[model samples]
Target chain A: MHQKRRKRADERRAEILAAAESVFAERGYRAGSLAAIAEAVGISKQTLLHHFPTKEHLLVAVLERRDLHNLGIVADMGLTIEAMARLVDLNLDWRGLVHSYTVLSAESVAEDHPAHEFFTTRYDRSRHALADSLRAQHGDRLPGGLTPDQAAPLIIAVNDGLQLQWLLNSRDVAIGELFRAFLATVVKGEPPAST
Target chain B: MHQKRRKRADERRAEILAAAESVFAERGYRAGSLAAIAEAVGISKQTLLHHFPTKEHLLVAVLERRDLHNLGIVADMGLTIEAMARLVDLNLDWRGLVHSYTVLSAESVAEDHPAHEFFTTRYDRSRHALADSLRAQHGDRLPGGLTPDQAAPLIIAVNDGLQLQWLLNSRDVAIGELFRAFLATVVKGEPPAST
Candidate 1:
């Protein structure tokens, strides 16, 4: 009975966080509120607070959920260019998530923003992890004189920039194909031949 | 007397727009207000309204002003790789403008955003102009079988993406040098030789 009750509480918390993600994505963190999140989850603010306690805590939870999701996808696919292409393919199915990530990241560039620490730390962690992973996998054999360290940031930048363009005009930009070509250039030390 | 009054009005309008740019840069467009802009320009909100009747109108004028400034710089610099590097160098002196542009562009991705039409049109115009200028200058000689058209978006993406990374970690990311190297990779079809 205790296990059953604990599972129910965990499920309710997840639902609240999910609602918070949508509200924050649509209205932005500064404009988003617990009241709106609670309404979306069909719960009272007090109940929502029972799970998150504060807006900042809820925002952190949402970001942590996304990080875990993203890391899982990458790990499942292996740390290859193919993995990145797959990520882009996945992005197409969830434009909301992409928008949330992009908006929060741009907003987080301000030093005082609540998400600043989250994103700065995120980039640092991702860049170093990717660099080390690439080194362990490919060593110095990568193309274009790109050390794993160099490729790490460039790859992350392209992933992000392409999403911005793609979100603006999805019909014109082929996110997966473009990312694949970028990866090919890195692997071959030259731009891929036009198809 | 009429001529003098008209010139003064124009000067005040310009001043107000400049202040708006700074405010929107420091706080996002949605969070920025006419009162703040007026305070920045040492004018009354009533006077600000005389120049730009609505917040959207002021936002549009601010964007147009920036567009004009950017066009003037690129025209003077001749649209070469060096020109792009020069732009990056220029960015170092105006972190606020860079932050404003980055934040606004990301926000403008939403269809209902006030800057939506402005940014969508801006990208279309820029992409076409860059493609045409590149073609006229480089002909079909671009590396990797890339037409000027193909390279335009990629270059723009890299430019915008690099700004984001640099903004987040200015001390570590050498924006101008990194851009120069990106240009060299395009020019030579390979990474530039180490100096």
Candidate 2:
């Protein structure tokens, strides 16, 4: 009975998070409400509270879910040149998701924000994982004499920086092309190809 | 007499924005209030509203002031290797200002945000100015084979991206060192030296 209840609770939490993501993505964090998220999940406010306790908590849960989703995509692709391609492809594939999360993540930097710790850890892990993969792929042959830690952040930074540009002018700047250029420059030890 | 009144009004507006910057920096956007800002400026709420109209308008004004400040800094430096170095220096010199603006800028990405247009234009102007400077420096050399337009966003992206990382872990990374390395790589048309 306890196991069945646990399974049911986990399922409900997942459902609520999915609903919250939709609401937050559509309405943004400030405008998104717990009541609306509950309604979207077909749950009473009390039930939503049982799962998330507060709007900040719900926001954190939604962000965590997205982070896990991103990590899964990165992990499944495995560490290869193809993995780099896949990373770019995945970001483009989920442009809305990427855009929404980027905006929300930026907002999450406020002191006392529930998602602050989550974002910090997520950044650390993502950077480390990508760096590890790159190290594994090229080993001693990696150009630019970059350690995994330094190179990892550079890759992450490029991804984020390019995303902002893409958001502002999507037609002119292709996120994938930028990412590809970044990868080529790092791997080949060349300046990015002139536009 | 009319000129005196206009100058007085501009001075009062500047005072309010200065106070707003402090309040927002200390308490963040969500917790910051017009009342708090008024108190900080030693003015009544009515007097504050006379100048700012609303808390959101005040926030927008603060952002506009910051954007203008950064633009002025970039412009004063002129476009050359010195300008790039000055950009790095200004970021370090005004680290607090940079942090405050970055945190607020991230929050202002909401679709209907009053500051959205301001940020968009600020970004465009900053990028274009940097690109123009870079073009002048190269004088048709096109070292990386990339146009200034293509390379300018990349440069901005690295700076912004690195800022986020530095904010997350200032102890782990030296912002100035990273930026200097980045500028060296871009300006010298070579990869970063292995260190």
Residue pairs in collision within model 2: A194-B145, A194-B146, A195-B146
lDDT of each: 0.80, 0.70
lDDT of 2 by residue, B115-138 (tens): 667767767876788778778878
Q: Pick the candidate with the highest lDDT.
A: 1
- Runs of candidate 2 with Cα error greater than 4 angstroms are A1-12, A25-31, A138-142, A145-147, A191-195, B1-11, B25-31, B93-95, B139-141, B193-195
- TM-score (C-alpha, index-matched) for candidate 2: 0.84
Q: Compute DockQ for each candidate against the true complex.
A: 0.55, 0.44
TM-score of 1: 0.93
* Model number with the top DockQ: 1
Candidate 1 docks at the CAPRI level of medium
The sequence of per-residue lDDT tens digits that candidate 1 reaches over residues A98-193 is 887887788788888888888888888888888888888878546666667677777787788888888888887777777676666654466665
